[model samples]
Target: MNRMQLAALATVATLFTACGSSSDTGPQPVAIDFKALVGTQTFSCADTAGYAIGTGTLPWIPKDFRFYVSNVRLVDAAGVEAPVTLDASVWQGYGVALLDFENGTGNCTGGTVETNKSIQGTVAPGSYVGLKFDVGVPTASNHLNVQAANPPLANSAMYWSWTTGYKFMKIDGLINRATPFTFNFHLGSTGCTLATPGDFTTASCTTLNVPSASFAAFNPTTQAVALDLALLFAATNFDTADGGGAPGCMSGATDPECAPIFPKLGLPFGTTPAGSQASFRLVTK
Candidate 1:
């Protein structure tokens, strides 16, 4: 080839390199989506028709839905896990992001109006086919310091107290009754011991209660994480509060209500062995 023609080809290559035709520019941005559902119905504060729940199939009004997800990792085609470099926001930071499904409208009146249905971040350019994540906030910022933590961590509605720590996940609904009481599922790290009972925060919790999930064929671009409330309440009796501290499961070790609830999360509680997690499933959008 002529020298002039070779020089022209080299210039074209440089332009392509500058435009980042491949992964040389850096990682790509990814937004893993999530949604709340009771069976096939997409859950929302605007739903006036309550969903049939529990064994009786009583209509249960969606009240509140929110949870913290941590240690998010994207899985490659070869089954290798890569940690997500999360984007910082009011709902995301510090290797954790709070997924809020409620908008404080209709029956979901107690929480904030803002909703975060996706985990925004960056991932290496590759053929990622799966996802892995934990169901709670990480230990470093999860131990009773909402006052000092970052945005999503600083959200007070999620935190309970200095002794108990943050309520890792909360999914509540108004159930059938003479009064139509609310059934609250406040799952968090229990069996805690404080360093100083009166002053210091919790030193450690015997039951971390951080259940995790991994889906082998998930696609962040075309699929979303669906948290199903119907299957979660399959064994729970909304009409009766049995062997429990509250009207619903409160993550207490002795609470029989929690025993049934934990297995739905693919976790073992008391005599109830771990079952496949029924609540979280990846669905095609």
Candidate 2:
């Protein structure tokens, strides 16, 4: 009961130590594939229709589509949160990325030759259950001068100015049967304060307007994140403008035009939405 028992116990202890070290060591890096889609269809610069979104039945031909997302996170199967490491590039900087599907073609006159359809990043390998991200730029970076800001932030089309900051999201299209013939949806932080025209040390916006999106069972590798424009406008009449006379929602709290669209953007009539209520849907391709 002495030497044999000691040797057996020693072997078991060594085995347990090895297993524990394996579990605690660094896991392999996971490649997260981010894709943007419109319903089941692939969203691109080309013309497509049959978008039966809102009660109104006007066919939509997309001319431009772009949006910003930051603080991207993934919840592993173990319920551990892991932030994504964005690939360094013009379209991505400071943990933010701009998803641009338009390539300055057709009616996309305000765009450029380059377009970013998706963004890829790395995370610690694990079985992820959900994904979370913010729709707009954080307060610290929102008020910076566009010319001096990072790549995507420096892009003029995305910036309203140093005072107003950037456009969180922009989706524009032509409504086939609408009277106005256009549907433009732009979202950004409002109610911002600046000491001067473009002051860097401006006060935080009353309406931060950064709606957070969370997805359950979102696979970072096999599945793609989708934003269905049809659902976004399912209740909107693109042909008509609100009392404020905007063709579509433009992040204005009082704009009646935004009444139907704001909820979809995770923003209510006059307040930011709860973190869990995002308008974006996940699509697998």
Best by lDDT: 1
Worst 10 residues of 2 by lDDT: 16-25
**1-285 per-residue lDDT for model 1 (tens digits):** 677765654443332221323333366566788988888989987885678777766677878899999988888778998888888999988678999999998888788889999888776655466788989977666774567877888877888674447888988888767777788898888777776776445457888888888888776656889988887777777767455576777787887778767998988899777766878998876
TM-score of each: 0.87, 0.80
TM-score of 1: 0.87
Error of 2 at 202 (Å): 2.4
lDDT of predicted model 2? 0.67
Model 1 spans with C-alpha error above 4 angstroms:
1-22, 162-164, 196-202
Question: Candidate 2: misplaced stretches above 4 Å?
Answer: 1-31, 48-52, 124-127, 176-181, 195-198, 271-278
| Backbone clash tally (model 1) | 0
Tens-digit lDDT track of model 2 for 201-276: 5746777767778876765445666777766766677655446745666777677777777777667675544334
